[model samples]
Target: MTDLNQAIETLSHHEEGVFPRKALETLLDNQEAVNPQLLDYLESVAIDPTGTIESWQTDFLVVALFLLAQFRDVRAYQPLIKLLNKLDSETDWILGEEGLSRILASVCDGDVTPLQALAENPEIAEYIRSEAFYALLTLVCRGQWDKSALHDYCRRMLEGGLNYEGGYLRISLTHICEMMMFSDLLETIRNCYQKWPEMSEFIRFDEVEESLQSGEADEFGLSFHRDYITDAIADLEKHACFVAGDGAEGDDLDGFDLSELFGSPDDVASEVEGFFANAETQETFVRDLPKVGRNDPCPCGSGKKFKKCCGK
Candidate 1:
């Protein structure tokens, strides 16, 4: 327990016990020393995630990411982005939706360009890319970025054109508009629906219109703003991801049954995992995003080639 590697090992190698709070405490006390090691560990994992996936029984990676983010360590940003870029869906099974949100939001390094890339890159997984959209909100909420700039950026992204394959990105942007209360973007959002009619699976035009009609953003809090160690510890204190010494696993679904967090492996276009605050509203976002084949007639039925119509 004298070093971070040992602490990481302790957290990683445990079997049938409570979360190893002691090891985490040791690393937190030695944050300055552990940060270098933490960055290395993150970079190594980001470079080659095989080790993490192969030895996936423990909560160690969770500990590593939470620790790095707790300190807002800029060194970890690129590695974290790389990890997500190179990440397979199996790895996301471990991070879960909320976990992904926390990590992406804090690791932005005050420059959202990387996050913008992640959000815009259709090659990356949808859930991962979608989280980046919300991470912008987190930055704005924390007062680190200008909401107006974000609004303009989002408008440009909207104007850039959204194809069928990346329809979910438009929906994610729609969610952002609601959060920021961008009434001016209402027409832009409507245009998105016009282009990608399938967006109704997650949100209806009237719903967005009604939400905007209220003219207020809902209270939102996704990232921690208090003491890092205390909040990070609080996050896992009764969590079910790890087996603690006391053997008190919390009531939430265990990590083993986490397929719902991403989607059924058989389905490529995954369903939604709730990251929203209201239960009813969260349900509105949950659906297995339907895919539109390239050659098939466009759903919008503009009487043109599918590609010429609402194309990806």
Candidate 2:
């Protein structure tokens, strides 16, 4: 058995990928039963840190939570739930909410009250709420809930439709319709054109009918178009909200095309080092690398096509 003491000690450097995956895999592979020590370690990592210094710990924690689920033990559920409670659309923890949804999809088992609570909470960020909304939708669509109850749930989802910032909600709605198939909600979505008459200019059904007549129609094509209309209705304006600006040194190369100088990343790094060591060689360092055709034999002489070998 792998030493549990060493595994727990290595988590202080959880920002590195190898330790978490190895530690969790060891815990999962060895014991037939759930270990309280392992569970405690998962809980500590899963908790969102208040300081930015350990911000990347959230990513490590998410990986741990997912590894916990592979064992199918219910003990992992509560720690995963606590991660869901920390979802913030504005936060840098990209996987915290998304990872929770993925883990819950398999383990919730008809108990989606926690998901519903997060979805209904107005205080949560809109993006996180939309994620929770889709997670609940996924459960309802897959679970063996009563037909009437399912219908009610779908109605509530459409009625409480999301505002289309970042276009995430529309994407979620499209997925829900495609997965759930034809239902009462399809009719409800069709009637949305009448209720929001202004959106009619943005959405049209003529092409959908034409495609159906021409045998070119796709499943849920109408739902896909409706999602587009939802985005159009929002009259999206460019916002710097999610746009990541380049670093200070990179900002000076605004109109420059940097792709002309190319080589393998390692070769480029070596050239950069050489240039730093002797500034006079800068001009000669940038040169084109010989290109290899995809179908040609690999230069490595392993007797395989380049595309099928290292080119991949």
Best by TM-score: 1
Candidate 1 overall lDDT versus native: 0.66
Candidate 2, TM-score vs. the true structure? 0.51
Distance from true position, residue 218, model 2, in Å? 9.5
Highest-lDDT candidate? 1
Candidate 1 structure quality by residue, lDDT tens digits, 28-93: 989888888778777777877767777664256677788888888877888889888875445565
- Model 2, span 86-190: residue lDDT tens: 655455244432234435544565566776676666555554555555555445545524435545655665565433322233334433443445244555555
Clash totals in order: 6, 0
Task: Give the C-alpha miss distance for residue 253 in model 1, angstroms.
Answer: 20
| Whole-model lDDT per candidate | 0.66, 0.46
Stretches of candidate 1 off by over 4 Å are: 1-6, 14-17, 55-58, 161-167, 220-230, 238-240, 243-312
